[model samples]
Target: MLEYVKTILQKVSFNAYLFERELKKGMRYLMPTELEEFKDWCYATFGMSHQPILNRYFRPAY
Candidate 1:
């Protein structure tokens, strides 16, 4: 599932809206444990390009 999400993100990376939408969808499909790893991977992979979106979604909640 993680790999699938990665693939989708890669495929849609050209469009910020699509990337963010897929990221949101990916979150719904991943487990809690998977999210931590996913968050890490997201930053590592898309941080430079989509930092705003990733930050908005992955920031620690209060």
Candidate 2:
């Protein structure tokens, strides 16, 4: 799961620090539209529940 996130970040040239900061800020959960699309993509590609991994990577803004 972490590996998948790392690969995506690497592909996008996202810095580790920046990625961690964004995740800490709850960027993924805050952006429901994008999150939904990402979930769909993960489901189609990996055939697994993305919520578990997503919860690990991104916390709710609240």
lDDT of 2 by residue, 1-62 (tens): 43455456435333445544543444343355566555445446433423444456545569
User: Would you estimate the TM-scores of all the predictions?
Assistant: 0.93, 0.32
Return the top candidate by lDDT.
1
lDDT of 1 at 53: 98
Candidate 2 local lDDT, residue 57: 57
Q: How accurate is candidate 2 locally (lDDT)?
A: 0.47
Off by over 4 Å in 1: none
Cα displacement (angstroms), candidate 2, residue 21, comes to 14
Q: On a 0 to 100 scale, what is the lDDT of residue 48 in model 1?
A: 96
lDDT per residue as tens, model 1, 1-62: 99899999999999999999999999999988899999999999999999999999998769
Question: RMSD to native for every prediction?
Answer: 1.3, 8.3
